[model samples]
Target: MREDAVKEGDKAPDFELERQDGGLFRLYELLKEKNVVLYFYPKDNTPGCTKQACEFRDQYEAFARLGAEVVGISSDTLESHQKFEAVHHLPFTLLSDKGGRVRSLYGVPRKLLLLPGRVTYIIDQTGTVRYVFDSMNKPLEHVSTALEVLKTISHERNTQNV
Candidate 1:
């Protein structure tokens, strides 16, 4: 399959998706407020997705302190997200993209017929995609890698303003 993922410096296509918590999230709105870590996973409650979610949850406070918000998207329904979050104590937003529309906008590939491919996007404060990770074998590294990019950008912006 062709990798249609957005590249760094490209304006990320904003989307409106249903949250597992019964709310609507506009990607641009969140980007306007803070940098975003938009991650896409195969399925809710699955092994890899769960590991990715928990790692984000564990470091959620640091992400917030860095003025970034982490959000996960999957084709799963709101009910599934709710159950997964409750069972794992996830501390951030879980978006339910049942239609896979948002997933397609992000160009998340379909590696498995049964699961959405593992991918993550780090959006800068200006709403541009700063980084994209498409590998599923090393899920935990996704968080750290995204954080490093965000921190570098945040530092550079601060330095320029000073």
Candidate 2:
């Protein structure tokens, strides 16, 4: 693991990438509205990546209820992401990180030093990473873990207000 790898409580590295819709997406800009569940996957249309994306899609409403927005990033082309979103009916934004720069910025370690990493980062509205799940085999767990973390954060914030 890279020593500079983003960890919980660290500020998330900012990035800009093309959305599936061909529009630009800036990490800090999205952070202004709600918390972000930023996930980095390996590829588009692959079995594991598809399962992970669908899992996020299925739990998307729950994330929204918690005032969180889910975003997926991979080093795929914009056209590929568009097709993937259309085919899977993914409800959240999918960003195309063509060169994996953002992936490297997050210090997402490649699986076995070969394939791109499968990792998820739950970033709070304040731009701090609240949680990170790194796993290549258990894609579906990413959704459940992120949702749980977001719920915990929400609960903590509500309790502090009382």
Best-performing candidate as measured by lDDT? 2
* CA deviation > 4 Å runs, candidate 1: 1-3, 112-114
Tens-digit lDDT track of model 2 for 1-162 = 568899999999998888888788999999999999999999999999999999999988999999999999998998999899999999999998878899989999988788999999999989999999999999999999999999999999999999
Model 2 residue 82 CA deviation (Å) reads 0.5
Candidate 2, residue 122: the lDDT equals 97
lDDT, each prediction: 0.87, 0.93
- Going through the candidates in order, what is the number of backbone clashes in each? 0, 0
lDDT of 1 by residue, 1-162 (tens): 346767777899988988887888999888888999999888887788889999999999889988999999888889999999999999999998888998888777887666578888889878888888888788899999988988888898899999
> Looking at model 2, which ten-residue stretch has the lowest summed lDDT?
15-24
